[model samples]
Target: MPMAADDIETLIRTAIPDAQITITDLAGDGDHYAAHVVAESFRGLPRVRQHQAVYAALGGRMGGVLHALQLTTAVPKE
Candidate 1:
């Protein structure tokens, strides 16, 4: 089964409690998604690491239940 938007948000929030997340279904099919995540914890992280954190939050669902995800991460603006 494809992952739900709420599930994705919940998982990320679980890992990064202060994340501001926005999820979009790019294909109109639950399988493909785009996530924009902003968090204080990402302040000094590299882009690759930021994305990795989000991936980790999903618990290895990428390329399995959740096929494609276009992810963008940023630190919250002051």
Candidate 2:
């Protein structure tokens, strides 16, 4: 079964408590998603590391319950 968008957001929120997350279903199917996350903790991190953190927040579901995720991360605007 495909994962719900709310589940994805909840997982990220659990890990990165201060994250500002926006999830969009690129396709009508729930398996493909795009996530844009903003967080204060990502301020000094590299882009790769920031993305990794968001992926990690989803636990090990990347290839199983969740099919594909296009992720973008950034620190909050000043």
Candidate 3:
């Protein structure tokens, strides 16, 4: 079974309470997804680190219950 968009969003929110997340199914399957997230936690983090934070939010779900995630993270506009 693949992950649900709501699950992805929930995971992100669980980690970053103020996160704004948008999830799209890249392959029309739940296994492949693209996530665009904006959070205050990313304010000073590098792009790689920001992504890492989001991945961590998923609790290592990448490549297992969740197959692939194309992630984009940003801090909220000032």
lDDT of 2 by residue, 1-78 (tens): 999999999999999999999999999699999999999999999999999999899999998999999998999999
Model 1 stretches with alpha carbons more than 4 Å out: none
Number of the candidate with higher lDDT, 2 or 3? 2
TM-score of 1: 0.97
> Which candidate wins on lDDT?
1
Q: What tens-digit string does per-residue lDDT give for candidate 3 at 38-73?
A: 998789889999888888999988989999998988
Task: State residue 58's C-alpha deviation in candidate 2, in Å.
Answer: 0.5
RMSD (Cα, Å) of model 2:
0.6
Candidate number that wins on TM-score, 1 or 3: 1
Model 3 misplaced regions, further than 4 Å: none
User: Model 1 misses residue 42 by how many Å?
Assistant: 0.4
